[model samples]
Target chain A: MINCKALTKKYGNFVAVNELTFQVQAGEVLGFLGPNGAGKTTTMRILAGFLSPTAGKASVCGFDVETQSTEAKRKIGYLPEGAPSYPEMTSRSFLEFIADSRKISISNRQRRLEEVHELLQLGTVLDQKIDTLSKGFRRRVGLAQAILHDPEVLILDEPTDGLDPNQKHEVRRLINRMSERKIIIISTHLLEEVDAVCNRAIIISDGKILADDSPKNLESKSKFHNAVSVKLLNSMNLNIVDSAINSLPEVASTRIDENNNSLIAFPTKGKTPLEAITKLGAAEGWDFSELHVESGRLDEVFRSITGGTAR
Target chain B: MNGVSAVMRRELRSYFSTPLAYVFIVIFLVLSGWFTFNFGNFYNGGQASLAPFFNYHPWLYLFLVPALSMRLWAEERKTGTIELLLTLPLEMWESVTGKFLASWLFTSMALFLTFPIWITVNYLGDPDNGVILAAYMGSLLMAGGFLAVGSFISATTNNQVIAFILTVVVCFVFLLAGFQPMLSPLVGWVPQTIIDSIASLSFLTHFSSISKGVIDLRDIVYFALLISTFLYANVLVLNMKRGE
Candidate 1:
């Protein structure tokens, strides 16, 4: 387990991370979400034992991060922001260097190397210089080093920030593959990633966490939750669709999406208006192209929850 | 031990990976030859000793050692590898000393390649090879001192150029501290003991003292102290900066 208690960090006068407290249990993949300069990196650095907290404390696997950093760091696999590695070194030598630094014994070294190589798919780029490899390979190389020792706690900062869609999916798969045993915390602004991999998401804006819960629970807080959405064949019928949907007694409000030729009807408290909307559409003989009830709009909740705040 | 050797091995490999290593070695050899024969007049003296060669090493190291040490920590910061390194399960001193040792060994190699000169002098006339060996030891210790100082300055900034310049400036002071011209102005205002202490701290003073065919323990201790003090300072700077 990773425990952080009231962790705070200050850069002279400004507080980069303010009175933050959270714990991560084994088998948990926690996603840290925040705007740029919202203290996500700072908080991760503190947990990785790179920076000391001005107040409170953090520990990894029962070892204190500040006082017993060496012991704590031994069990941590931290991929710092930007996935920094020596550009001059080939990927193979660089991983060997990490293995040597961590003092992985000779008998166990080959197995460890092979494990990470398979986990990160680093075979083709092993001999290539890190400088010439693409961003995706460099990121995987960083991940390879982080997991080289088979550490228990994995802290990755923006692990997929610069990758393409396919590469991002591959990295997510790798994370999920390793999520069964390790305590993984990844910080990113990508909300869908939280929905895809994270069992829990923590959203912070201006150096403080505003919400922490399962992604589904956070999404359920959106105004679009359980809201009925309908797409008509023509945008000219938006007014008719909006008025018809709002007339349903279960609908608390309605919105028109002119761009997509769709209208969304928000359900009243403790009600799902999808069934009522379908009945109403059938009675009026409205030609609907698409209709579904949204669980939530993460983007809308993200904006409303983190929007209009000072950085 | 594992951490130090791993860091040192990687550092050494990085040096060789770039053409900088070969360029530095060639320039060092060529400059040492030019200074010894042209300025010190090795043939004209005809003493059969490598006195001319030994005499110019302090000046030679002033420029070259800083070039080698400038990349020690500065490059790590610039490339953002310092984060990867420090987060590993290694203590601060291990990385610092490991980098220092790698640069020192590289300098030692460049110095060792000058053995043809030593052999040439012996073939020309009968010289005290023991004194020559002692001079080689002194030269290496002085290079180690210069490298230690340069490494400490390297940790202070991310810009290699800035590190190079500041190391040159500080080492220039160490070289000139014992000179009469530099000290004459302070001779009156500064107290006698303070002046003596400053003079004792000069690299030129202890370095030249060992060149007189005597490997004094005090001189060795001076270089050792110089190396350790600056290396410890390097550790302190790293602990404070945390590579920014």
Candidate 2:
């Protein structure tokens, strides 16, 4: 639905987004993952036809952004960063104004307006001026305006930036439900949001697309090492524990938390750590209380890939 | 249905959405009415025309038009909503024309509210309604000219104060071009054609002519061309900034 070819945005000598190319398919939810100022917003702005790229080309729904901007703009709904809205306008009036500007028919306008209001849960606040609404409510109002005409693609830049936890979840749910029909690309610093809403994640850093894959695949690739946590019921001699585990061929390294009576182990090649763990437990006759294994988390994958803290 | 009308409708709605619209109207009416009664000596202009009312318009619009147009683009930039607006499907000229017309129409409404002065003159004297209508047209044209200049100045910056100040400076230059005392020093050396051109560009020259019940094609074309030029420039400015 959206395609970018070596798109680069430069503000004088500073490059905001550099030579980036990617494509999002129809009905795909692409998460634009980046640290702050990593050119996610810049790239999204260019695609939304707000800012022109200093070099290269971008298109939305088959129309070039620079040449066919109006046609491209007509095909997309953009929720800009901070979800800016006319503070003096009521939610209903704002949506109606957008609908009119988009030239939606009166019969369909009412139905679409109703759909947005219900979808964003803006019914109660529809009559209230946007200035009087909270940040979350105001953001929802922006979302309502974006989706009122139901464009083919939705480009949301930090859709849930300043929302409470519950509101964020609500927005995530709405995005997921909307994703069934429209191609949605969201740029956010919050990794959990991408995990919850996006099936495909694109990690960008320094204006470059560092990684692009499914969330599960990214997790597995970055998380080749598994961390197993264990707590023992009784005191265990540290040297004996380490000697036993280190001697095992499957065990690469062993660290013992004598205070908590736990063993943290890394696996060796061509063998599973579980085998070593089971063998050590059987031979040492050690009393164990808890053991749990977790797959690599999104934060680890993101940090390892982006080479910086997720800001 | 047209792009210009769509933008105009939204702009007009926005004016009422805040205190800005009401504030400008009240200030415009009170000032114009006060000037008409006390300063212009409406009781003794000794003629049957809206002379006193039309006379103060150039000065009134000097301040009022800036106040109205300063926020046209500056506020959009300040709030970052300009990004959303410029990306809309409408052409830049359509939005500019729409916004300019809305402000001009609102200014005309404020100007028209002084009709009671025309009524009072007709009630008390043998006033020519045709001349009065012509004066209103002239005042509107002059107001449009000032608004166009203001719109152009507003597009230059994101600060409303800067927009207002710059627009006033530009309008002042236009006003000074025709002031007899202000331009008298240069009259000796400059050729009459150049002097006439300078005078013709002044608000007082064309507007005063129209106020005398004369709708000269030159003056009418002057106002329309001036407004269109500035609006075209406004669109270019938006495109240039967006294209960057």
Candidate 3:
């Protein structure tokens, strides 16, 4: 549904987005992950047809963003960064104005307005001016305006940036519900959000795509791969336990947690830590209370890719 | 609706929704009335027509129109609303025309409120009502011209104060182009035809002619063309400033 080739954007000597290229298929929720100033917003703006690329070309729904911007814009519903809206306009009037500008037929305008109002939970604030609302409500109003026309693609920049946890969950659910029939590209730093809602995630840093893959795949590629925790019942000899675990061929490294005396183990390649643990328990008769194993989280994966902590 | 008309309606609605439009209108009406009756000494002169009232329009629009237009695109950019506006399906020209018409129409509302002066003149003497009508049209056209220039300047920056100041400076030049003290010596140095043409480009020259109850097609076309030219420039500026 969206295609960009060697897209670059610069403001004088400052490069906002550099020779970046990516695409989104129809009905895919592609989460854009990046630290601040990673050119996420600039890339989204270029794709939305708001800013022309400095050197390359972008197209949406088969329409060129620069030459055929109108058609390209028609196919995309854009919720810009910071969720900007006219402060003086009531939510209903604002939506009506956007609908009219988008050339929605008058006959269906009322229904479409109601549809988005209900979808974004903005019915109560329909008559209230946008400036009077809280940030979360205002963001919802921005969302309603973007999706009011039901465009084929939705480009949301930090859709849940300022929302509280509950509001974030609500927005996540809303985005999840709209996943079918729309090419949704969400640009955000909330890594868990991508894990919760996006099928595929793209990690960007310094105006370049670092890694793009499924959330699970990203986690699997993390450095702390297949690590596990084994807590003891506190009756075992530390030296004997350490030697027995270290003697295993699969055990690459082991460290006992000072506070809990739990053993943290890292297994080498082509080895199953669980199999090693079971065999070690049989051989050494070690008592343990907990044995848990899991892969790294999306946050760890994101931090590894972007080379900075995700805010 | 067309994109221009849609933008125009949004701008008009913005004026009404905020205090900006009302404040501008009230100030415009009071200043217009004060300039005509008090400042111009209406009763002392006992003028038969609205010459005293229409004479001060250029000076009034010099400041008033800039205030109305200062926030046009500048405020949008400052607040990041330009992203929302430009990403829409509407073409840039449509947004430009719509915003210009909105400001122009709101200005016309403020200009129209000075009608009581036209009535006051007719009440005092047998003023040429045709001249009053022509003067009203001239004032509207002149306001349109000022608004177009102001809109163009407003599109250049996100600071409304800067927009207002830049527009005032530009409009000052246009208003003074025909000043005899400024241009008379130039007439000797340059061709007389070129000097006259420069003088003719001054809004004061064209607007004063129309206010005299002579609706010259050239003057009418001049105002219309000036408005279109600036509006076109405004669109191009918006496209360039936002283009990557």
Candidate 4:
């Protein structure tokens, strides 16, 4: 497990991370969500042992980050924000050097290198300088270095930030493949990413965590949670249909989207109004299609929890 | 130890990957040869000793060593690779020492490549090869001292030119501290003990003794201490800088 107690970091008078506490266990993929400079990167850096915290303590697998730095670092793999590396080195040489620094036994070093190369699909560019590779390739190279040692804890900052859609999918799949046995923390501004990969999400703002919960539970905080949405075939009698649906006590309000010929009814409380809406549509003989209830909107929840600070 | 060698090997490979290493070695060789022949009068100095050759090393290294060490940390900082490097599972000192040793070895390699002069000196007349070897060792140690200072300065800034200039200025002070002309000005006001102590800290004071064919443990200790002192400072500064 990775643990942090009141972890904080200050740059002169600016507090980058403020008294944050959290714990992550194996098989947990934690998503760090925040606006830029919201201390997402700062928190990750402190955990990765790149920057020292001003106060508080952090540990990985029971090893204190500050006191047993090498031991703590040995159990972690970190991919920094930009995936910076030696531009002069070829992918093969750089990985070899990392393996040597890690002191992987020579007998299996080649095997591990080959595995990473194939996993990242870096065979074509293994001999090319990192500077010559594309942004996606460079990012993959950084990922390869991070997982070369198969560390227990993985801290990745914006792991899929600049990738194409396909590349992003591949990277997310890879993360999911590894999430079953390791502790992973990925920071991203992509709200859907939290829904896609993160088991739990922490929404922070101004260096303070505002909300922390599983994605589903967090999404429940959204006003759209459990709201029934239906696509109308025509805008004819839209106001009548909206008013009739809004008349029900369980249905708090209704919104009509003329652009898409759609109308949505929000629940008054923790109520499932989808069946009631379907019965009303049938009894009223309304022209509608694609009637469904939204579990929640993560973007709406993120915006609400972060108080319009979501970037 | 493995960590040190891993870093060292990567550092050495980086130097060779660019034209900088070749250009530096060529310049180092040309300048040393010019100083030894045109200025030191190696051909006309009625002596079989490589004294003329060894005498010019301190001056040659004054510029070359700083040039070699300037990019050690500054480039890493500029490129943002220092974060990846420092976060690796190794002691901070291991990285510092690895980088220092790689540059020191590079300088040593360039110095040894001047072996034709050593061969020429031996070819001309009977000369004590033992003294020459000691002089080479002294020169290598002095270069190490210069490199250590450069490494610390490099960690202080992301600008390589600034690192190079500051290292040159600091190494110059160490080089001239024991010069008789520079020291004579302080003869009246400074106490004799203070004057001697300052002179003892000079690169010239320690390196000259070793280059004179005397392998004194005191001089060796001086270079070792100087190297470690600056390298330790490098670690401390790097810890605070964090690629700033």
Candidate 5:
């Protein structure tokens, strides 16, 4: 539903987004990950038609963002970073205004407003001015405005930044619920949010895309992919277990976690360490307390791809 | 068109929802009344004309109109609502025209509230109601001219105070351009035609002609062109902000 080609945006000598290109399809939620000043928001703003790119092109639902901005914008529901709204207006009034601007029919406007109000749980504070609402409520109000018209594309910049854990979870769930019908692109620094809500993830750093793949695929790039760790019920001869586990053809290497008295084993290519560990436990009478397979760590991969440097 | 109306509705509501609309109207009424009675000598003028009342509009709007126009875009920029506004499926001209109309309509409301002055003149003696109507129209149009300039200046900055100050200074220059003192300095250094053009650009010159019940096509066209030129610049400035 969205395509960007060699999209470059510069502020004088500073390149905010440089030759960044990506595509998103319907029924896909793409998580945009990057550090501060990594061009995530800049790219999203370009896609939302709020900022013009210095070079290259971007389109939403086949409408060029720069040339056909009105058509492109009509398909988009954008929640800008910080989710700013008119402070003096009530949430209902603000949403109504947004609904009107979106060209919602007068007959359907009230129903649409009520729907978003209910969806975002904005009923209690619907009549209160936005400036008087709490941070979470204000963010919800922003979300309500973005989704009020039910546009096909949703570009949310840090949709869950200031929310509490429960609010974050609710927002993630909302995104998940809407993922099947819309092309949702969310830019956030929270790795866990990508895991929970995104079907695809792109990590950007210093105005360039560092990695783009499914969260699982990106996590699998970590060194810990397919690694297994086993904990013994009693602190017995850890070397014997380590040696026995290391002798298997599937085992690539073994390391002892002395603090936990556990043996962590790395598997050979295309190998399953669980089979070897289970067999060894059965044959050697190795009493196992905890045994599990790692899905690989996303944070490690994120840090490595982003260079683990403070922007 | 829907976008324009949506923006206009919201902007008009914003003025009323806060203390801005009421406070502005009260101050405008008081000042116009005070100026007409004290400096204008409306009661003492035996002719029973609204000349004193209409005469103060240009000077009154010089300070008051900026206060209304300063917040048109500066507040949106400062509060970051400009992002939300610009991202919507609305055109730049729609938003600019919408905001300008809202402020102009609000100013018209304030102008309308001075009806008692019109009533007072008619009650005290026979007055030219045609001239009074013409003056109201002229005052509203002059407000538009001042507001368009102020709104354009507002779009160039994010600070409301700076927007207010700059708008006042610009409007002041435009108002003073036709005055003899200001024109005298330019007469010797500049060509006669240039000096004539500068004086022709003055709000006072055009407004005075209309308020005197002389609604020339040129004066009306001047105010219309002034408003259109500044509003066009407002849209351009907003577009430049998006580029930045």
Candidate 6:
């Protein structure tokens, strides 16, 4: 579990993290989303006990990050941005050193190392210097170190940033698999990553929390939610189909996508255009090739929430 | 304590894993040998004591110790491993002490390898082995003091080059603080007590006293205090870094 209250971090005249607060419970994969300079990494660092907040307090698993840093840190597995590691040391030794630092019992240390190495597929590069590994492999090594101790809370900053699609998918799956027992907080700019792995998402911008909810809830805020689009067959006229769909009580408006020869209908509040459209189609003998309704678009919601700024 | 040993072990391993450790030891031995035989005129002195060898340590460590200490914290910061290290469940003092001990142990190893010089001196003539042993202890303590200062400065910057230069400049001041040429100019302008206090802080002064084989409590305390002071500063700097 992670709790942050009015956590603010400032560097001289600039405030990196404003008076922001949020809580994450165990077994929750919370996606931390923000544009660049939005205090996402700063927040993660504070929570990881790497940086102390200039104001307010943050705790991981109920231990205060500042006053009780060592205890707080004991419960956290942190992957800093860029996945920085000692370049000269082999990956295996590096993880072992981390295991030792984490105070893993000597009996369990070797077992934990083997388990993480196998999980991250680091066998091939175990004895190789970390500097020689590819970026994806290096990122995996960082991931392995974070999960080595299997701490109660995992604070990963951009965990899947440098990984390939497959590696990213594997990492997401790993996070998902581990999500049932630990408090996982992943800070990422990737919208699709949230959709793929996160059960809840928090969107922050300019050091402030703009939105916090489930990924589905955030998507439902998009304009496309509950909207319907139908592709007309060559036999049907676009105007007739559009006007007929638009005339329905549930239909708010209709627009024709001329390039695709499709009719898109917008529904009014608490309305379903699917049943009305099906009835109209059956009665008028309107030929349609495809029909579907959109749950929502995450990118649209993210762009709107983050003010369309590139992170 | 476990955190400290973990960091110490990793640091020691890192030193040996790369070519840096070998290169450092080789350079240290060669330079000390050259200084003792050539500059200090070990063969010409006709004395059986290791005076010529220990005399050059203050100057030798000025450059060599900084080279060793510069990478202690600067490399971690440059490589961004500082984040990984600090975020672990280790205290700031634990890591600082751990890293300092590793560098000190490596320096001690290099100092130990110069045992052949001691053996040669004993082989050629009957040297005062007691005095020689005391001088070795004094030299290592002085090296620890220099390393502590260098390590503290290294933690303040990310660039090893900058750390080395700053350490050299600071250590040079400490080395020259008691020297006549440096003190002569300040004698007329400053008070005699102030000059005496400044000279008392010099590494050369305490090291010279210890090298004489007396091993006074004051000299030992001087090096201890200097080392603890610098290491305390190292811990404070890291704490400040965490705040930043």
Q: List, for all models, the DockQ compared with the true complex.
A: 0.66, 0.68, 0.81, 0.62, 0.75, 0.78
Q: Order candidates by DockQ, high to low.
A: 3, 6, 5, 2, 1, 4
Which number leads on DockQ? Answer: 3
- lDDT by residue for model 4 (A100-160), tens: 9988898889999999999999999999999999999999999999999999999999999
lDDT of 6: 0.92
Candidate 5 per-residue lDDT, tens place, B33-148, comes to: 99999999887777899999989999899999999999999999899899899999999999999999999999999999999999989999999999999999999999999999
Q: Rank the candidates by lDDT, best first.
A: 6, 5, 4, 1, 3, 2
lDDT string, candidate 6, B1-244, tens digits: 2888999999999999999999999999999999999988899998998999999999999999999999999999998899999999998999999999999999999999999999999999999999999999999999999999999999999999999999999999999898898799898889999999999999998999899998999999999999999999999998898787
Isolated chain B TM-score per model: 0.97, 0.94, 0.94, 0.95, 0.98, 0.97
What are the runs in model 2 whose C-alpha is more than 4 Å off?
Answer: A223-225, A234-247, A254-264, A268-271, A309-311, B180-196
CAPRI tier of model 4: medium
Q: In model 2, how large is the Cα lDDT of residue B159?
A: 99
How would the docking of model 2 be graded?
medium
Instruction: Summarize candidate 3's per-residue lDDT along A142-225 as a digit string, tens digits.
Output: 899888898899999999989999999999999999999899999988788988899998888888889989888898876456
Better of 2 and 4 by TM-score: 4
Q: What is the CA-based DockQ of model 2?
A: 0.68
Model 3 CAPRI rating? high
Per-residue lDDT of candidate 1, residues A1-311 (tens digit): 99989988888888888899899999999999887999999898888878878899899999998889889989999999999999989999999999998989999899999989988889999998899999989999999999999999999999998899998999999899899999999998888899889999999888899989999998898888999888998734788778878888999998788999888889898899999889888888888999988999776777788885321
TM-scores of all models? Answer: 0.97, 0.94, 0.95, 0.96, 0.95, 0.95
The numbered model that scores best in TM-score is 1
Q: Mind giving the per-residue lDDT tens digits that candidate 5 earns over A27-129?
A: 9999999889999999989888888999999999999998999999999999999999999999989998898898998888889888988889998998999
Residues B107-197 of candidate 3: C-alpha lDDT, one tens digit per residue: 8888778778777777888988888899999999999999999999999999999999999989988888899876977966799899888
lDDT of each: 0.90, 0.85, 0.87, 0.91, 0.92, 0.92
RMSD of 5: 2.3
Q: Which wins on lDDT, candidate 3 or candidate 5? A: 5
lDDT of 2 by residue, A126-197 (tens): 999988999999989888878877889999999998999999999999899889889999998898888899
Q: lDDT score of model 1?
A: 0.90
Residue-level lDDT of model 6, residues A107-184, one tens digit each, is 898899999989999999999999999999999999999999999999999999988999999999999999999999
Taking all chains together, the TM-score of candidate 1 against the true structure is 0.97
